[model samples]
Every structure is written in structure tokens, then in C-alpha cells.
Target: MSDTAAERAYRNCVRNLLAQFIHAVQQQPPFILDECDEESLHYLEQLESLPGTTGNEYAELGQAVVCRTIAAFPHLVPLLPRDLLWHFGGDCLHYMPDDEIDKFQQLDERLHQAIGEARPFDYERERAAIFGLH
Candidate 1:
């Protein structure tokens, strides 16, 4: 089946967030390594090896990374991009409040509508506007 607008948006979001997550991890101090449990470390290793991964693989790994962080290294959860949580949408959604989820749902609907109408849609700009980000 052809991908929907929401699916395309999710894949793009996951890919971008994975890169952002990797960059954020690289900037962390060596001491942070001491904080990761075996599972978290394993997920980090897999995440580092994500170059050339397919969209489905990126989604799975992104979900794993987010869930593992919430479970093992809660303090570092802030390092993850919030959009990743909403894009993957499973246990990840549990991390978001209802109001935040509603905003994301609206964003997805807007993306779908814009794409359907052949209008230009900028995901980041729309997201920032919805979330009231400057």
C-alpha cells in the first residue's frame, strides 16, 4: 500500500530525531557512560549503528531508545527530542500529557490535509506554531 501523509511525516521526523539524538549523545561527557545499564548501553550501540537504516528500522530503534531511556536513564530523557515520542506513538505516548498528544494529533491532521491539497507544509514550522515555540 502507498504510504499516508502521516506515515511519511513520521518517517521523516524519526530520521531527523535519530540524527539529533546521536549528536546529543556524542556531546555527552564520558561520565554519563557510567550511568547506563547494560540494556541502555546496548540500545545506544544499536542507535550508533543506524546509518543507512530503513524507515521501519529507524522507527523501531527510535521507539527502543526512547523506552530504554525512560526505563534506565530517566535523568537523560530530556536529551531525546520530544517529537520522537509523538511520532513513534506507543508506549512513547505514555510520556506525553493528553494536551500535548492532542496538539500532535492536530499537527498530523494538518500535515495530511496540506499534503492532500498539494499545499506546502513545513513540519517544524507547523510544530513550533502549534506548541507556541518561538
Candidate 2:
């Protein structure tokens, strides 16, 4: 294949694989990466780079990374049996309860209002409401 075609194929494959791994990590918690193709590793470097980039570019990069991961790893589609991935991802990020359930209730109300206004959820909100939101 040509260089572009090769890169696209590699990207697609990595996306799919990482998507599967991510789903596994969420569902199973602490999933291991025994090994990965060199291409997969390279793509992961790029995908992970999103969190380091500045400003809204990070969000754009995050979206691209997710899209690529999904495109490459269709297996993850089935693993997401429900919206539970959000909760799992949040847990992975250590979003434990702060003060009490009441705090969360207030946040949830605010979230619903913001969501109703069509404002996209921030990472925290997205992570918290994965299964609950959609």
C-alpha cells in the first residue's frame, strides 16, 4: 500500500484495538497490555498526546483519538453493553464522592439544565453520566 493508505490502515487498526482494550479496562478494571504491535503503540502515543495539548485543541484531539480508536476497534462497540462505560471511566479517574449524595444531586440538576441547553458535557460530567446520560 501507499504511505497514506498504510498509515490510514494502521490508524484504523490501532483505534479498534485500543477501543477494545479501553472497554476491557473499564469493565474489568486494571486490564493488562501484555503486548501491542509497534503501530498500535505509535498510535497510542498520538492518542494519549491529546491530554497534554493546550486549549480546545485538546478536546478536538480527544475526539479524533476516540473516533480513530472506535474505527479501528469495532469490538469495543459490543463491550459497551450500556452507558456504564462513563461510570467506569470516572471511577478510573478517581471521581469518588466529595461531600455527600446531596452534592451529586445538585450537580445532577445543574447538569440536566446545562444538557438541556445543548452545552456539551465537560470530561467530568461525561465520565459521571456515561450510562446515566444516554
Please tell me which predicted candidate would have the highest lDDT against the true structure: 1
Distance from true position, residue 94, model 2, in Å? Answer: 29
lDDT of 1 by residue, 20-77 (tens): 8877876664326667566556766876877566678867876776787778666667
Worst ten in a row by lDDT for model 2: 84-93
Each model's backbone clash number? 0, 6
| Model 2 C-alpha lDDT per residue in residues 1-134, reported as the tens digit of each score | 22343334433443554455554534431123555566566656665464357556754555555555456655544553222222223332222344433445454565565555655444344435543554
* Among all candidates shown, the one with the greatest TM-score: 1
Q: Model 1 compared with the native: what TM-score?
A: 0.77
- Give TM-scores for every candidate, taking all chains together and pairing residue i with residue i: 0.77, 0.36
